[model samples]
Target chain A: MRKTFNNELSKMHVRFAEMGMMVHEAIFRAVKAFVDHDKALAHNVIVRDQAINECENELEKMTLEVIALYQPVTADLRDVITILKASSDIERIGDHAVSMCNATIRMKGSQRIAEIEVEIAKMGDYTCSMVEHVLDAYVNRNLERAYQIAKDDRFLDAELRKIRQRCMTVMQAAPASVFSGSYYISVATYLERIGDYVTNVCEWIVFLQLGEIVELNPSSKNNL
Target chain B: MKVKRIRIIRTFFSDAIIIFIFLTVIFLLVIRQVRNGSVSAWGVETFLLLSVTAIILAAVDIFGRYLRFRKRKQNLEALNSRLSNIIEGTKGKHVLLEPSDPYYELSQSINAVQSMKDMISKSFVTQQRGYFSLIEYLTIGVMVLDQDRKIYLSNHAMSDLIGREMNLKKQLYVNVLRTYELSQLIERVYQDRQDQHAEIKLDFSDKVVDAHVVYVPVSEHHFLVMALLYDITELKEIERMQMDFVGNVSHELKTPITAITGFSETLLQGALKDPKALKEFLNIIHQESLKLTELVEDILSLARIDASPELKLDEIDIRKFIINLLRPFRPEISKKDIHVEIQIPNGCTVQVDQNKLRHVINNLVQNAIKYNNYKGNVWLKGTIKKDSWFISVNDNGYGIPKDEKERIFERFYRVDTSRSRQNGGTGLGLSVVKEYVEAMSGKITVDSQVGVGSTFTVIFPLELPTAPLNESTK
Candidate 1:
């Protein structure tokens, strides 16, 4: 009886991982689109997120079914529970990427905002790495490594803030540049928000790894 | 009845006395008659009376001897049965008596001796079974000593535990000590007579044996001692595992938290005066804070699953369930340019805890999309087989390694941990999926190869039970 239960759990894990792959792809392309400023690619990222949403729903249903039937214990129980949590994070990550795409579309065709793309690109890159690192941390049960990625997210935020501050100063120096500066700020903000989402994923990873609800940031680091 | 039997014997004695008196009276009468010349004298009559009296006395003596022997035989048989029962693995108090079966005073003294004997026997057996059983069965080493420290019982397990068979009888338990700790315990229990226990550590075997001893006072001058044993090898291993788990979790949580808190503190101290620095700090703070939230949420979910596994369950249609779930993700799918195909029979239902099952299905489907190739098509299929409904989500993505598949369900376990994080996986997804699936009495499996793609299947048995309805209630 226990063997059968374990077998069932194995199947569920595979399915969850499969669904995870889709969201991972969506985010992957979304990051690429942000860097290349390819409208078509950005559109693709948005479109793929729908599949991620569908997967999120389906995986949740599967996990619930398993819990009802098998009543797994110890590690098996923890695994299913972690999947339920991970799907949300994965789905949210997909949403954030698509949202970024939307932001890109909004800021498109505005030449004045083009210069800020560099900073936005930097932020996007850092956010992308954060997203990737947290996913890996989740899989590896490397809570330490996962936390490090979360810690590294600070750098991405700092870049976004600097871009935002520079855009404001430019707007103040040349009142006519207000429109352009606003776009820069928006892009910076979007990148910063993406970083936030990535951190969210990491927090869940830590929780999943440890089976405890600890703050991802150290208590002493909570000044912000 | 005994009094009546005694009365009958007394009556027989009186009757004999009366018969003697009558015979004497008859003789006198005959003598008188003969003297008077009324009758002829007869010697034969006198001889017959004398012979009958002799026969009656002999029979009484024989009967008395027979009664005495019968009583003694009954008493001996009762005593023998009691002794045998006590020896046959039963515990209690019973007295042993001397061989003499008659005389009430002597019997009482014998009973006293019997009590002491039983006490000694019980203590002996208890001690041998308690301590020797472990040494005999679980380990190799067999050695036991009596109160005087004489060897009493030794088994093969004891020999193995001790590394050799050693005669332990008649020697002081302390003086012959192979291990000082064990000897000390024996001495302590012997002196105190109260319950005492100790752990005997073995350096060679790297094992610990728990030993317990108790002194039993059987009489004013006699005492009995007993000991118990147990092995804690497996227990020690579990302790080590628990410690490792804690250590790993602590370090993992500390790093990120430190960065977030430290950066925030630095910004607050004076960085805010510079808008750029302040904004940068804020951004970092925001990101770290979000990560902390996710971590907390994951931990909460894990704890919830572990603590109250008996969540609510309900019947849900498989086809409708999948369809309803898909409604929310259509936007994401369109944006990703991914195609999702659903193959499920209409009206097929499975019993499941809705919240948990939704989580499982959501995790798997999301993965399919997140890792799929550009413009990849995901097949979501459901079928009924025997008593269960099988559902699968197939994705065309970089699949998992064969070796990593089994370990994937472990908490925080990952194949390519770094890449998994890159994909925004918390690693808890598959593990949680496994836990809920098992709890629901369902089965989940994965078929995958690196780069070939992966197929995940979930089998949920028919869960809604049919109940007979009473027309009145309806």
Candidate 2:
């Protein structure tokens, strides 16, 4: 019975790690679609999110089972708890990517691209990097790096500000460009959301390791 | 000690009986000698020796019994102190006793009881902490009263709500009885040991606090009273805003919609013969369609922000960011007589969702420029302090009213509704700012007065590359 419990726990950890990786990949692929304007890639990312969603459901069930059956404690319990939390965040990131995919499809419908595409692309890239780093941090238990990625979102905000100014200018010059501007604005928003989910995942990772939840930023330490 | 006393009494009785037997034997021998008219010296000597030995042995036995009794009494007193300590020790943890101790079974049971008590009190402490923290965090006041009508516990929120502790010793219902009808209901329930609920408006200093009271009998001698505070100030404002939103949408759209429908009706009735009328009707219809589109877009954006105010943060270069931001606004800068100054230092970075952050900054700067007089200056500055980054936008424009400063962030809130309408403001910009700023773990504050200028400053964390501070981590 003990051996079986151990095997089941290992299986759950493996599945949770896979889910985190898939979310990381989805975020990257969605941003790539935005940058490259590849509708096919966007469609793929949108479709693959279903798999992540399934993984989330399965992880939740497995975690609940472990808690009920084995009644694990300390590190073993922390592992299950973190997986439960991380899966939710991963699912949300997938949903955000799907939203980005929908935004891309909308932009395609309008067939109008804005002049501030670079700014939007940069924001997407930065957010994707954040997701990738956070996932790696979770797998390797690299809390410091994970925290860094979470804090890095503010820099992304600065880039988005520039994007907005460019869009506003375009809107003022050509009133009809408002639709295109709002679309790009939403794209920047989706990227930012992806970054936030990554940070949440990293936090869960640290919590699993330390049995404590610490703030990501130094300034915000006062909050804790 | 009682057993030792019994032993002592038995020893004294045994010694007296032995002494009586010895004396009787000696007396009988003496009587025989007197009858025989002669006595032996050895016999007398033997009698005397036997009597002395009995007396000495009795004295020693008495002293020994007294010592044992005293020792037993002292041991009993020590045991009582040890038992009391086990029950009410200062340490929260419990310790088991050895099995060989005199009160081993009792000690084990006591230890078991002590352990259970520790668990209960630990959980109770945890719950108390959690409850008070929630109350303190909430913008509500809660008070718990005993059956005697005295305050047993009051949350910090409740204290802040009532402004002072005047009602701490008094009947809670009596204090707010005049302000709310619900207080009387609570009083009735508490006095009668029945369930009661009430809603009262509390004057917490200048601000009015809407309080919902629920009185539940927790025990025969104690009652639980909960006061839920809903800062109706915001709720009332939201209600007004919703009314204005509906009113504004209808009023704004009615003009064009009415014109289009009427003109179409007229044209259908043969007014199409006149080219002027036909062109005018078509123009009105086009304008109305545009208005509908704008209204739909505003509604959609507001809904989106309200539904998911969850914006993510990422890292970006501050110097390049500012340069990039200003590049597009160059035209606005050149066309208008406004001076746009960026006072942010190079390499300054923050963590926030790039898009929402941009939206807020763009809206503020745009508003500043839009409201500024000709040749006016709009200053955009970012300063980093010990723990946070403060971004300020100052504009010399039509200032806001003191009351409106706080309400300006409400959806569809406007200082001058007419002027805002003329400027094509949908009144959702500041509300969006507030939502995004708060979502990004930042605070937005505005300092303004009538006839003076307004300065809106957004303060966010500086070490934001790792994570934004939120309640979950704490």
Candidate 3:
């Protein structure tokens, strides 16, 4: 029975890793579609969101089954619970990826302000790294890495704020592109939300290790 | 030395006391006899003689016993030295004792025990050698950790995985592995006393390894953690490639299907009432259908190539083959004002599948003409080697970038996606060409420079082999 429980746990780990990879790909392609202004690629990203949802549902079901069957304790219990929470965050990140793609689709053929695009791309990269690093930390049980990801989320928050400010100025200057301008803001907002979701994953990792629900980035909570 | 002297003194002192008591008793008896007047016939000489004889007999007996004691001590000392030598594994001769010596049988027993020990130790050494050799030659990485989490054994495969030889004896597993996932796996195995598995990516090496760590119980209180590492990077890459292939196929198929559907739906939504609009839309529908047909054909060819590419080989005249192949492209060549050069020696023949070879040549020529700048040159050259024929398609056009040269032949890999779409060329052309070329027992290579030119060459054997080559030959 213990063997079955452990095997199930390992399967859950693999599924979580796969989900993390899928979310990573979604974010990457969504950002690429936004930067390249390729609607087809954006559509592809949107379609892939369904796969991510399915993965998350499967992972959630597996986690619940393990919990109900084994009633794990201490570290094992902490790990399963963390996976449950983190998989939700990952699924949310996937949703934000779709939202970013949706924003890209709304932008259509309009030219984005070059500077804001760069800023948003930078934010996208930062959020992606946060997600990737947090996933790695969860897998390796590296508390330091999780803490680092949480710290990096602050920089992403600042970038998102700057992008939002820049988008407002651009909208005021070019009233004709207000529609695309709003999408630019929306993309930035989605990326920021993704960063927050990654930070939430880091928090879960912290809880898994310390059994304490300490927020690593307390100030970002208000923004979220 | 002091203890031995004390032992000797103690032994002799007891004997001396007993002899003294006897002497005293004899003297008292003599005194009694003299007092009773019973010694009237006894002389002093007789008395002295008796006393000397008794003392000599006592001395002889003591000396004889002492000799025996000394001999026994010497034999025991020899036996002890031999035993120590055997324990130390030194080559030493056994002590030979006289048969009359009391320690003879003891000496024989000591020799027998030593020989048995020697035999057992020799066999143990051989077994150890065999065990180490077996481990050294094993392909799977193996490491054993004792109950203290110290490394007790590691194989060559383990060292290779680590990228260096490690002094693993008594070394902590974490200090050796340095990978947190694997270390955690080992720790879990140790704690749970069960087999555990993890997929670990190493920081120092570009490898993904599947590690199986098992707990081996040596005794009631002693156990070992054995870890086996199997590199799964290639398997992972293949898996990713399969996933990418499926995704690309879906995306590629979706584009034309969407286009065909949209245009037909527009026509059906009353665009057919406008004659000019209807014509344009029908043309687009026709073009998308053609593209769809090409895509399906390319997919089928790729699938065929994947599933047993059986070639029907035939000898073909190179000059005639080129003429026939270029006949269809002649009008396009002239329209684009591109210079066409065909340099094939007359009577130059090679063995290949005629239909597959035609397909290969056609794809390369089409790509050459389609991608070439206006009035650029396309050269088709055939040369003969000792055992093979070389056919090359060289184009002076918007050449491929240097890095993309390697992947240009990959299925659906395009240098510029929009450009390929504009040129109306399915991206699978080069991949199909590669497959057909390889199917005919040939090799293909490409060289390209950005904005300069690109040359693709295929080499085919002069005569097709009657039998298949060994699979390992590839």
* Index of the highest-DockQ prediction: 3
Worst 10 contiguous positions by lDDT, candidate 2 chain B = B172-181
lDDT of 2 by residue, B1-474 (tens): 455667667887798568757775786688677767444444867666766777677777778867766765555555555557656655543334456655567656666776777788899999999986886676666666655445556666666655444234444333322222334444565556655543344432324556555666667755676545555656766778789878766776676678778878998999889999889888878877787777667667767765665556687665566567667777776677888777888777766678877878888987887776566787888867899987899876665654467778876667776577777766667877887777676789997543335789999877553443344122
Cα lDDT, model 2, residue A35: 56
DockQ, per model, reads: 0.01, 0.01, 0.02
Candidate 1 structure quality by residue, lDDT tens digits, B353-400: 888888888989988888776677789999777877888999876566
Cand. 3 TM to true fold: 0.49
Residue-level error in angstroms, candidate 2, position B448: 2.3
Candidate 2 has a DockQ of 0.01
In Å, residue B289's CA in model 2 sits off its true spot by 3.2
Q: What's the lDDT of the predicted structure labeled candidate 2?
A: 0.69
Q: Model 3: how far is B76 from its true place, Å?
A: 4.2
Compute each candidate's TM-score over C-alphas.
0.33, 0.43, 0.49
Ranking of all predicted structures according to TM-score, beginning with the best and ending with the worst: 3, 2, 1
